[model samples]
Target: MVKDEYTLVLVKPDGVKTRHIGEIITRIERKGYKIEALKMIQPTEELLRQHYADKVDKPFFPELLEYMTEGPIVGIVVSGTNVIKAIHNMAGATNPVEAEWGTIRGDYGREWPDGNLRNIVHTSDEPSSATKEIKIWFPEFEFTQG
Candidate 1:
């Protein structure tokens, strides 16, 4: 039997600036996933640092941080069987150039002249990351036992 799985999806700053939030949500709903929770937040440096701890020390982290903080982002908790992997696939490749034409990033993302890749969304790569990330964006949320 298929079990309900949850994942975190962040429509990053670029996506918000470009006003694609509605379209993104429509796509997610079209996939038959339930949006359990959603909120728009202007992320703090502390919050981003916690969420991107693994990438904090990377060379381009500052650029990434700046891009993320440029505007408010929409955080969504989506639930469905295999939603984590499915959403990741829907988000497309990290680089829009490498993403498939129909995926979110491929359709709405682009590499800026500054060399930053403005991917439209961020989805948890796995269940553990989803749990960790969901807390970062939705601290008040009650987690499932699964």
Candidate 2:
């Protein structure tokens, strides 16, 4: 088992403004995942650009970045067994309309007719993404040795 494996979870701007942070935390806890560290942040432009570098060329990327910076986000380091995949499943799809009913996005998020995706949460895609996202979001954080 991969003990202490962690994933980066971002309760996005919409989630924060909607006061869904508590429910999100509750669900994470209910799933038996541990929150190692958490904070609210207003991400800088450079940080987000780097984080979403791959999408920079896409037309919708600007709106995506703008939406992310609209409000403060709750960033958390969540530890659990196979958290990368497990958390992804719990978060559901990026588009709430297509997400499964029980998942976070499906349950709490809404779909806008203007084609904007208002998904409430974002999780690291895999181990590599988790590592990169952790570094981007929490550079000063040091992992304690077991």
TM-scores for all predictions: 0.97, 0.94
lDDT of candidate model 1 versus the reference: 0.94
Q: For candidate 1, lDDT tens digit of each residue in 26-121?
A: 999999999999999998899999999999999999998998899999999999999999999999999998999999999999988998768989
lDDT of 2 by residue, 31-71 (tens): 99889899999978898987888888999997898889989
What Cα-based lDDT does every candidate model obtain? 0.94, 0.88
Q: What is the lDDT of residue 130 in candidate 2?
A: 90
Q: Which candidate achieves the best TM-score against the true structure?
A: 1
- Kindly report which residue stretches of model 2 are placed more than 4 angstroms away from their true locations once superposed: none
Q: Supply candidate 1's per-residue lDDT for 50.
A: 98
Which runs of model 1 end up more than 4 angstroms from their true locations? none
